[model samples]
Target: MVAVYGGRGPQTSNIQIRSIPSVVRRGENVELLCEVENEPDAAISWQRVDGDLPYGAESYGSILRIPSIQGGGIYMCSATTRQGIFDERFGLVIQEEFKRIVKLFIVNNISHSTSEVGKSK
Candidate 1:
């Protein structure tokens, strides 16, 4: 991740978050990832803009797990190193309707093959 810190920030190795756009079905597995890299490790914290968070959910590195699919909104992660704490925020929107679009594009290439088979038959 490439990130910018303000006002006497820490000497971070890589201060950036990778962009991950997930398209998942409801009642299934979904994982959202935000990563940060720094020397000597950094203290990381996560907070959801809306909704509740599961208890005892902390990791050694700058990683957070949603565990289950649920409602979504903006989320932010901050890292505190020897210099200063750097922060990054990202928006997430979850909707069932969009799952169909994902299914169509990701899975149903079968339609194209079926049409070809029909022509041969």
Candidate 2:
């Protein structure tokens, strides 16, 4: 198999990752979309930063879906066509303090009235 594009005519292919904000909260589902354009058939593989091996799929491009966010890490996708193989990686991080603040706000709202929480001295 060819690593890069190798065809009769000029070969060209592009791969990109599309999704919402890079920073996401834990327990949220994230969909990683890979868009690719090439000749007839192309192979795509997606793996997390700590992934073991690559999984293969047939098509110009594809999407990798994450059911829920467990931890912070990076994700990668590699595409191989008649032309060539290209790889890209994306990173994710958890904002623990910010999330904690949000949780606190939610708890306070449920337990106490806003006026009580913000009473005048």
Candidate 3:
């Protein structure tokens, strides 16, 4: 007796972000990578979940590049194949350099003032 078996079909699964910075500086270029485990021909797409996509953002293959990361929000990547579709989300937190310096100054001044008040008492 002879038996015939069919090969497995394309499937989109184990979608993940290969690399992404936890914190991105304003006006800096950033690249986010999305990977699928089994499907090499999967089509990848990107979308912003929390806000509008940054200006000049584009996707090449499985990589999403932002010419300049202006604002911070949730970004999602979708991988589609013949068998199924998978998605993964990434959080992009943006920090402004000037804002950080100003915030530090304000916090230091507040602390200094509080210490002075306690000493006076």
Candidate 4:
């Protein structure tokens, strides 16, 4: 008689995007990482969920690098294997310096106007 042991088949799970920066400045380069627990032979692909895939997007294994972060939105990475497919999402936020400066100017003007009203009374 021959003895054989059966084990679970190939599956993809635990797909995650790692080390996303909390803040990213406009026009800066950024890298987004994707990781998945899957069969050894699984393949990974990356996509932009919000807009057309960036022109400079490049992928090496599980890492995707964007030459410049022009806009803020969601990106997706997917892992595919013979057994199944799994995917995860990451969000990039771009902060524009011009917006901050304009906000500061408005705030200063409001403060000055309030102070003048108080002095008039």
Best by TM-score: 3
Alpha-carbon TM-score of each model against the true structure = 0.54, 0.59, 0.68, 0.66
Candidates in descending TM-score order: 3, 4, 2, 1
Candidate 1 lDDT tens digits, 5-56? 6577733455554436645444544444556554446777777656555344
lDDT per residue for candidate 4 within 81-119, as digits (tens), equals 555677778888888776444444444444343344546
Worst 10 residues of 2 by lDDT: 52-61
Give, for candidate 1, the lowest lDDT window spanning 10 residues: 109-118
**Poorly placed runs, candidate 2 (over 4 Å):** 1-10, 51-61, 97-121
| lDDT (Cα atoms) of all candidates against the true structure | 0.58, 0.64, 0.78, 0.73
Best prediction by lDDT: 3
Error of 4 at 66 (Å): 0.3
Q: Candidate 1 — which residues are off by over 4 angstroms?
A: 1-14, 38-40, 54-60, 97-121
Return the number of clashes found in candidate 2.
6
Residue 40 miss distance in model 3 (angstroms): 0.4
> Which of the two, 2 or 4, has more TM-score?
4
lDDT of 4: 0.73
Whichever of 2 and 4 has more lDDT, that candidate is 4
**What is the overall TM-score of model 3 with all chains considered together?**
0.68
Instruction: Write down the RMSD of candidate 3 (Cα, Å).
Output: 12.7
Q: List the residue pairs that clash in candidate 3.
A: none
